[model samples]
Target chain A: MATLIRYALLLATTAVLQRLLLDQIRIADVAADGFLVLSVATGVVAGSRRGAVVGFAAGLALDLMVLTPFGLGALSSLVAGAVAGSLERLIVHSARTLTLAVGFASAFVGVLFFVLVGSLLGGVGLVDGHLPVILLLVPATTAVLVLPVRRLIRWAEAPSRALSPALR
Target chain B: MILLLLTAVTLLTLSGRGFGPLDSVRSAVGSVLAPVGDAASWATRPFSNAWDSAFSHDDLVAANQRLQEENDRLQGQVTQSAIATEQLQELLALVSIPFVGDTPVAHTRVVAGTAGNFGDTVELDKGSDAGIEVGMPVITGRGLIGRVRLVSASRSTVELVTGGGFKVGFLVIGTSAVGVAQGDGDPSRLRGANIDIAQPVTEGQIVVTAGLRGSSFPPNIPIGSIASVRSDDAARQSTVDIDLYASTRDLTYADVVLWKAAN
Candidate 1:
């Protein structure tokens, strides 16, 4: 219950920030996605299963806010989180390098999946010349945001850590 | 993971099929978040303006100078009162569409724009409570901008004219030619295809909405001006490119013209 409440607050806060501030801060006409960064960071902090669960919830929250097809954001975030969490096992102990690698690769895969799925569903404008710019920027932006978002997720999960028998 | 994926797929399928209950859920969520979004926007506006000023100071200065010159030119043109009044009415007729006469318009501020990379859309701060509904034409003083795509209790989304698959019926000024302009995923252009090769179209010719029976928009609403005309001999048709009059970027406020398509 505590975990659920913590994640809910985190998702709500991220969604608000995305709408107001992050959406306004555009670089080369493409804005950074705070939801994607948070999901990827959660994956880096937790494991693959927890990452997928959090990612899907986060995406669903995002879908409720945007005008896109209802499930697109959820699917993108879910896969991105899972991929990033799965990579956690193979990453070195250096926190900086791990977050950056996971953040970039996961966000890239997530956005690619979104475009491909959206195009197949008759989203004619989804795949355009500006795709290269989106591909370059979304992941790069996600990487820059990963470290801080991961720390926040870890802080939220601190209670769960304290209650775990192994930690005690 | 499998369970979650299945859930997402289910949601996509239900939403694509136009499930009505989902819209209620979306609206409910929007209602909950709208206030939070408004508060955040109010608090962060100063910082946002600062960021814009820091990056685009020179551009703003140039724009201010251009507006000053335009103001001076208009002031000089106002010479005699009676003549100016007649000309003012004529200018008003030219700028405002006749077919949109007395239609109740709901004015609202644009709260947000394009949430993701895929679509060209913006969100307005007023919704059904303000008499704004899906399919209503949104405009500024310049011309038509887009149509309302979705509406919640206090917010709505508009699909801009440049969004893919958007089509508007238009008539060429001073000619009998009519064509449908289609958006092809380009931000700054619309294409008019299958136009008769013999049509006398040229660069700089203005285009206005047809607003014929069953048309989406009202008649005489200026859409754009022709940028280029190409004759495709093999297809036996001419294609015309248009440059839109009302830009979609940086729109702060607009009016939702409350005329329905079927009406």
Candidate 2:
């Protein structure tokens, strides 16, 4: 029960931060990938189930705020959470390098998937001129955000665990 | 089991058959989350405004004085021009083209934007109560911005030309070649496609909205100017790069055109 509440809080906080602070910061003309980073952190700390739940909730929240087709964010975040959770089993410690790598990789795949799906939906026009700029900014912004997000997840998760004796 | 549920929800949403359960869930969640989005946008407003004010202070002051003088001089000219234009429009109204009604402009406050992607859509403070509706064209003196896509009681979402889902039909200035101008998910860039290669389009040619059959937008709204043209020899199609005239980065208020086409 405590773990569930923790996951819920984490999801809510992630959504808030994504809209507030993280969304505002633009590095290399790209805002930091807050939800992606949060998903990876939750997936790694908790099991895949928790990761999936958090991702779904966060993605759904994002979709509601954004004007895109409703399910796009949920689908992408679900995949991202599952993949990150699976990778967490192989890694022992939450080193900065590992987090950075995960952040960069997930950010890349997430953005690419979004663009591909968006293009297929017949709303966006494709042009070669801005592709290079997008390519450079996506990963770099993700890489810079890993450590801060890792710390935030830990902080947010600690309170829920404290409230639940079972978690202790 | 979880994946199955997720897939089911996704499929339902993609089909667009109106998912009541999901929409309720979204609205519930949005209600909870809306404050956060509002706070985020609110926090940034001051800084963005301050930065813009700093950069444009001298020029803006100078322009304001010049504009005052120009307005005084152009008052008579405008009256005469309005009469002449109205007469011409009345004559042209005889043609079977859909008539665009007079539009009233409204100013709105920005609410939120997309966080992750290059596209920056804004939620406005006005909605259905203010006579704003979906498909209403948004513009500034410089050029076209985008259109209202979604609306709530007190809020509306504008999908700027930089957003993924924005498309407009435009005409090139020199040859009047008509093509489709669409958002590239980047504010600074636009793409004009399906222009005939031999249309005499050139670099720096201004592009204006070419109202489609039954389109909500009026004819000849400024869109952008052509930057480059790419022609494929065998495909018989060409693409033109356009620089959007609207500055999405600094936009705070916009004019929501409330014109409806008279049948």
Candidate 3:
């Protein structure tokens, strides 16, 4: 129950931040996507299944907030989360740098997936010569944000484990 | 993962097909979040403005100079226009005349500047409740900005003319030439085509809506002024670039013209 509430709060807060504040601030017409960064950070801390679930939920919330089609964000985020989680085992040896690496990589994957899928679905302006700018900005912004966001996700997950080890 | 993928696909397909419930869901979500967004914007606007001003002092100075010159020029034109208006009014007293200014409009505030990552659109505070409907043209004091793309009970989205895929018929003032202007995925200018190469279109010439039969926009809605013109020898057509009179970056308010194009 505690984990669920934390996840709900995370989703809501990220949605609000993405929609109201971050979207208003643009660097060369491309705003950093905080929601995408948070989801990728979630995958960095959690395993594959949990990561995919969180990503799906995050995508749905984003879809609801934006004017884009219903499932574009969802599909892109799910793929990104799952891919990031699957790479967790390999990066466990380099655990010290895990969050940063996964954050950048997963954000790259997520944005690429978004552009490919969005263009296929007839979305305009996704490839209007800003693709390279978006690709670099989204991931670099995610990389800068990964450490704190990862800690937040871990903090949200930590209480549940302490409350019931057997439940895990 | 497969189930989630299937669900996402189902949603994409359904929404693309214009499923009614999906629209309702979007509206419900907007209604719930609009106030929260407004509050956040109000709280953060000062910081954003300060950040912009800090980085853009030189640019702002240059822009101020440009505007001062333009203002001086326009003031001269306005005086001439006033004289012409008086003359035309006396002549029009002989017959009844309907003017574009007589069209009903709903003045609305822009609640949010840009909504999503994919396209350039702004959110307005008024929607169907204020007679704003999809396809209605929106304009500011400077010129036309865009058209209403989506509307809910109390809010609506206006797709800016700079958004890729926005196309509108336009005519060059003082010429018989007409063409279609379209956003080229750039926020600063629009690309125009289908113009006859022989047409004497010059830089800084005004462009206004053609408002042909079955057009979505009403006639004489100012879009922009020609920035450049290039002749396409093979096609015998001229490619014109238009610099918009309205800047989307700092839009705070606009009027939604309630007039719809006649079929």
Evaluated with TM-score, which candidate comes out highest? Answer: 1
Compared with the true structure, all predictions reach lDDT values of 0.83, 0.69, 0.83
Q: Estimate each model's TM-score.
A: 0.88, 0.76, 0.86
Measured with C-alpha atoms, the lDDT of residue B132 in candidate 1 is: 81
**Alpha-carbon error at A102 in model 3, in Å?**
1.5
Candidate 1 wrong stretches, greater than 4 Å: A92-95, A158-168, B52-58, B74-98
Tens digit of per-residue lDDT, candidate 3, span A49-149:
77788888888888887767788888888887887777775673756466677778888999899888877888766787877988888887877787788
Each candidate: how many clashes? Answer: 0, 0, 0
Error of 3 at B82 (Å): 3.4
Each prediction's DockQ?
A: 0.58, 0.42, 0.60
* Model 1 per-residue lDDT tens digits across residues B46-126: 887897799999999999999999989877776665486576567758976455645789999988778766678888899
Chain A (candidate 1) TM-score to true chain A: 0.91
Kindly report which residue pairs in candidate 3 clash with one another: none
Candidate 2 — which residues are off by over 4 angstroms?
A116-168, B1-38, B45-101, B171-177, B186-189, B195-206, B225-243, B260-263
Q: What is the alpha-carbon lDDT of model 3 when measured against the actual structure?
A: 0.83
State the lDDT of candidate 2 residue by residue for B136-171, as single tens digits.
888876778889876655667787887655788888
- Model 3 C-alpha RMSD vs. true structure (Å) is 3.7
